[model samples]
Target: MTHELGHAVHEYVSKKYGELGREKSCAQAETASIFAEQLVFAALLKAETDSKHRFILLAKHIEEMIAKTYRQIAFYRFEDMAHIERTNGEVSAQRLQEMFKSVMDNYLGPSVDTTGVEFICAGIHHFFEYDYYVYSYCFSCCVVNSLYEVYKSGTVANFAEKCMDMLTDSGVENYCSALAKFGIDATSPTFWQDGMRLFEQELSELETLEADIMKRTYINLEKKATH
Candidate 1:
């Protein structure tokens, strides 16, 4: 609901798009939705007192982030290659499966055996829906994470207000210009890396929580032993 509300809010607040066309590019759309999600997640994290619950929340969010970024990127690559290969000739089902397996192997590395996972391509509806656009998911994830970092940094003055202004202007300004409102440079590789750091930060917190939970469990055991 929050994610949909984000999209609705963007369409409503952004005056530049007018009535005829009120939507952002794929990456831009995800940016708004994911940012709204971040807001909700932040509120939930703030209220939750249970360490285990906090760890679960972080773990789920990080898992979703990985799917949105890394997995989508891999899908995008497969689509790109599939499109290029299609021009040469009709891609046989077997050939497409082989292609899909190769792409997945490249992305997954040697960590997991993809052995007979060619069916994955046919299952993904996006591959049938578009030519090659899944990369936008990864792009938007990085962009949103980077923005969230800025919000948490305390360096930016009136960060939330500026962010709203930027969203309102998204209909008019391209991503580079829209992000520039926060002094974010999309051209810089660091901009994307900054976004990845959000994942890193969460994972670090989860690690700390794991240790704390384990220690508390051991201390409780010792107390029971004494009693």
Candidate 2:
């Protein structure tokens, strides 16, 4: 919910303020999604008697969200890179389909059934409106994950007020610059690596839960494999 609200703010800023406004809005939107996920997940865990169970459930759901975000955005990144490499703007839809298909297969893994659905290059909402909007989710997730780490650690040093200020200044700078205030340099490979590390951290928590607890909380892991 907060995530979508952030996007709403982004749109408003972009339409009203232009490039700088758009960048700030995007950063705010990204922050919204990232922080909200953590806050809600933590609350859920605290509320559950089976903390371990809730942990795994939330972990898996978050994993799927993160994976999907990366998968979709990765395709956007590839497409953007391709456009940059191209000499002209005359690429065919069929060509785009083929490229997108490869990306879907690569990131979707092989577990979830795709069956006869040609979802790869069909009906993507961003296709018509946002050229590389999918990547924004991935980028935002990375920033969010990093920010959550600081916020949750209780070491952010006025992070709450700072984040609020960041949101209000949504149209003043780009995502990277906004994140920079938090001491994060999004352009570095370390930034990405740190984001990926969160998945590992989540997975480790999942593994511990599975090893000692999930059977007690969940009833259908094997049958509902996706869950």
Candidate 3:
């Protein structure tokens, strides 16, 4: 539903502002969809009272964050590296795999065993289908995240109208220019961090929630055993 809204809004905006170039349009559309998902999730989280349900939502949210943000960024990095290496010489499959694993490790962190995980790199068809397409995911995620922060802060009155204006502007304005209306400078090095911080905050909340849930389960089991 949220994704559809993105498309609808994009269409509406495109009609008024003219169609954006394929890449910018995709990025804007994706930004709307991802932002919609975040809004829906936030609403659901607020209304939910059951610990189990909350935990499930948080887990799914975390998984989505990892996949959309970190994983996509890693893929982009791997693609960049692989292309650069290929220019120097013919990059062997093994060399490509090493490059993939190294980038994956940087994002996945120490907990994930990336050893012998070369097969996962093969699963991404984007490298063969299109050049540098994975970067859009990272871009969209970060842009939407920054936009969400703007909405949350209530710094901009008439936020919805501003968003509509942005969507409608289409390709007339570059992403950085479109986002500038909302006071977001997408080119800034700190811009991506704004998005990342949202994920980090959610992960911390999930950890705390999980710990509470575990404590409750232990207590219940102990009581049952004693009785």
Candidate 4:
């Protein structure tokens, strides 16, 4: 649903501004899609009444954020390292696997058993087919997150229309120029942090929910035992 909205917005915008360029256009579309997903997720969380269901939703949101942001950043770093190593000398398959494992472990952390996961890199077609493709996920997530913050601030009176206008202009103007109209400065150092803050907030909420759910479960178990 989110991706399609991105396409639709892209199409709608492109008609007005013309094709900006492949990379910028794709980035703009991705930004729209990710923003849509965040909005929908927020709406769903708000509507959910059951604690267990809300916890599930929150968990899924956190998982998705981690995958899109941290994991993709890890992949980007791994690719950078691999490319640099290739330039220095021949990187053996074993060495590549080791590099992949190191980066994966960095992102996945100690709790995630990454045993036998190194080989999985061989299956990732993007590593071969697309150059730095993983970074796009990170880029889009950050852009959308910053834009979503603007929307939530209630400062922009016509947020939807402004977004549409931004999309329309994206086809002609560069992403930074187009986003600037909506007061989003992608080049700012804080821009990425603005995006990351959304995930942090979601993770914090999820942690609280998990603790509450565990407490309720413990209470129920104790009640049953006593009865």
Candidate 5:
């Protein structure tokens, strides 16, 4: 519901662009949705005082971000591998499964069993048809997280206004142009570096909070046992 509202807000802001506005890149299409959800998430995180509740919210948000960003990009690997195989001949279904399992193991790590990766990969229609489209999720995740960091850091003045301006120009501009006003170069390697840094920061906060919560729990249990 909240996610869809993000899309709706984007549509409303971009409607004036007419056909041009409606025709956006897949990554740009997802940016607003992720941005809006993160806005809501940040707000909820600020108000929550309970450690256990905060952990759950933080964990869920981080996990979903990973699934949306890393997992989706991992899926994009399948598209790349399949296309290369197509140069010689049609890739067999079994071969596609092999490629998917291989990629899955790389991302999921060696400890986890990926026994039926084929069945999981089969559920994604884009696996066979979309070519190289899944990268949009990764693209959006990076852009939104970077933009969110800017908002959090106060690096840019009047950011909300700038963000609104960018969204308004959605029909007329690509992400590179849209982000230029903020001094954000979507083409630069630093763009990805900044994004990963934000992710690492979030993960560090989660780790800190988890440690504090566990220590408090231990203290409480010790006090009760002594009593």
Candidate 6:
């Protein structure tokens, strides 16, 4: 929907014919891919009967998705800035390693071990292929955030239908118009904030479940000791 519809409409409308709109279509396509993955993850959680594993799966998926998206976007932005600072100067392997390490530390926080993934910097195709394009992952989430809010608010009737249309019409339409249907302005920070808030909500749910499990485990251990 996002790819073909939202973007296609924007490109076609913005361009009048929408022959071969590249950036808008590509961005929308990328966003739709991630959104579809999220929908599948959500469906799995809903279908699962086991309450114990549901939150665990939810937590793991949330962490993995957010970490990958945020860190990769940050890496792209960092590389862009680094290149700008260096101008036409060449990028050394050590420089790339240092930059990758800095962002990994920022995103992984104190929870995960980064040593195992140090070599990952060498494999990032975006760092070489697309200058500063990796941040589109972050932008994709921002666009999805506002769209999901519109979905949840029930303000836009036939939203899914519109999305389906947009998908089929994939082109170089103005995203502003596409999102305006839902009263969203992608230029505003509020649009992205909605997505971040959703991410945080998932984190909170995970933490609460972890706390409950730890409490129960402590009680069980104490009972065994007493016996």
Most accurate candidate by TM-score: 5
**Best-to-worst ranking by lDDT:** 1, 5, 4, 3, 6, 2
Assess candidate 3 and give its lDDT.
Answer: 0.82
Give per-residue CA lDDT, model 5, range 124-224, as digits (tens).
87655665668887888889988998898888999998887787777778779889878789899999878777678778888988999999999999999
* All candidates in order of TM-score, best leading: 5, 4, 1, 3, 6, 2
**lDDT score of residue 52 within candidate 2:** 62
Instruction: Mark the 10 consecutive residues where model 6 has the least summed lDDT.
Output: 2-11
RMSD of each: 2.4, 5.9, 2.6, 2.2, 1.8, 4.5
Over the stretch 1-227, how does candidate 3's per-residue lDDT look in tens digits?
A: 87688777676666854443323556777787787788898999999999889989999988987788778888989999999888988999888889998888888789988778777888889898878778777778888778888898999989998888787676577778888888988888898789787888888988988999999999999999999
In model 2, what is the error at residue 186, expressed in angstroms? 3.0
Candidate number with the higher lDDT (4 or 6) = 4
Model 5, global lDDT: 0.84
58 Cα displacement, candidate 5 (Å):
1.3
lDDT of 1 by residue, 108-192 (tens): 8999999878898898887887555588778988999999888887878998788777777776677898788788999999898
**Candidate 1 Cα lDDT to native:** 0.85
What residue pairs are clashing in model 3?
none
Report residue 213 deviation for candidate 1 (angstroms): 2.1
> Clash totals for all models, in order?
0, 1, 0, 0, 1, 13
Q: What is the lDDT of residue 128 in candidate 4?
A: 97
User: Which 10 residues in a row give candidate 2 its minimum summed lDDT?
Assistant: 19-28
lDDT of each: 0.85, 0.66, 0.82, 0.82, 0.84, 0.68
The top-ranked prediction according to lDDT is 1
Model 5 steric clash pairs: 21-171
Question: Model 4: residues >4 Å from true position, as ranges?
Answer: 17-25
Q: Of models 3 and 4, which has the larger TM-score?
A: 4
lDDT of 6 by residue, 23-97 (tens): 444466656666665666677877986646977797777766575477767787668667875787887777767
Q: Which candidate, 2 or 3, would have the higher lDDT against the true structure?
A: 3
> In model 1, where do residues sit more than 4 Å from their true spots?
20-23, 109-116, 219-227
